[model samples]
Target: MSNIGNYIKLLRESKNYSQRKLSLISKVSNATINRVESGISMPDPDTLKKLAPALGASYEKFMAIAGYLTGENSANNHNYTTGGNLLLKEEMEAIDLISHIKDKNLRTWITDPSSIDYIVFAKKLSDMGIDPDFVYNEFVSRIMKKNRE
Candidate 1:
């Protein structure tokens, strides 16, 4: 089964919500819910957000599942640089971007000094149109420019 479908099913079951019940709570049509659950259609971001709360899943989890559903990782292996060898530029950028995430759990995961899942996390960021390297560079560039002023 597709990851989105699996996630929907898992959340639904976990929340004790049937397809119809979820549809009602999310204000999405039953057909839309069915389509998503059956892997027949990909829900748009707005619909996905509405459905997340209905299924008792956080928006971050929904976004992750959506990334998987849209084939965001299909062509890429989970590659990430790790260890204390990370450049100062990358570290500062990570800190800046992590600060912008309003979701506490996701922010914590992104900023934690240890136990970072760069592969999955980076994939998620890329799916959202954020290039990790680019973000790091931008953050560092801004800081450097500031210091030179």
Candidate 2:
């Protein structure tokens, strides 16, 4: 497995950034970057966010690499991969909410949910405070409509 520090170093080098330069750009402290690159420590979530764009990398992808989020092969199975039937952090939350659905038909239609991007789904559900049945019925309606066309 590749180390987070090594990846940081490589990314910094590719960007032609010295530790101080990277700190200046990323708003991360030089000491923190040094410790991270030297494999002595890792950055926190906030620090990783600043450093990622500065290094032209995705913050989410970086967090995943740092083990804050799930990796492709991780046992946590947090849907880091595309092909696997992994239930991600968000998916787990979605499952929790969906479990409250009293209607069996709606529940079964939404089964597996492996094809759903639970991250987005859960956020929308939470934000609107909408009932799961409404969401499920909407999805079912869409499918049925598409079938007719």
Candidate 3:
């Protein structure tokens, strides 16, 4: 099993939580949790966000374990990668952006690449002409500041 899967299983066992219980608390399906625990599938960013609080862990910690974010100032590092290719800058921004969204359905809809909402959102960001490097540095700075709080 993957390190993350083992970690989650251990945490669940320690908390005396059944898979069904975790599913209920995390709002992630029991079958998906089982698949994640068995290493048959890796949980995505949204799943990690849900499971982290339920597992009594930090979202950043889980993201690091899942190879989504670097342990050190991940927001600052656009070079963070997985599967040998540079991870998409847009995907990282999407994950961070979705985390703050209050509407669960909207978050899911925006994350779906095939959705019209996702297309429009992506278009908006593209039209902004934002500088990636500046954004990365600013995001990292904010995270560092938050950690100091």
- Give each model's whole-structure lDDT: 0.60, 0.66, 0.67
Tell me the lDDT of model 1 at 2: 48
Please provide, for model 3 over 1-149, each residue's C-alpha lDDT reduced to its tens digit, 9 standing for 90 to 100. 66667657655765768999999999999999999888899999999999989977656656766787764566564332232223344544444444456665665465443442344444566679865456657889999999999
Question: Which residue ranges in model 3 land beyond 4 Å of their true spot?
Answer: 71-149
Of the pair 2 and 3, which is ahead by lDDT?
A: 3
lDDT of 1 by residue, 1-149 (tens): 44566556655654667888888899999898888877788877788789877865455445544663234342243322344231233433443344444665555454333434454456668989989878768889999999999
Which has the higher lDDT value, candidate number 1 or candidate number 2?
Answer: 2
Per-residue alpha-carbon lDDT of model 2 for 103-144, expressed as tens digits? Answer: 655554543333245445656686788776677789999999
User: How many Å off is the CA of 12 in candidate 1?
Assistant: 0.5
User: Which residue pairs collide, candidate 3?
Assistant: none
RMSD per model, one decimal = 13.5, 15.5, 15.9
lDDT of candidate 1?
A: 0.60
Top lDDT: which candidate number? 3
**Can you tell me which runs of candidate 2 are displaced by over 4 Å?**
71-149
| TM-score of each model, in listed order | 0.45, 0.47, 0.49
RMSD of 3: 15.9
**Could you give me the TM-score of model 1 versus the true structure?**
0.45
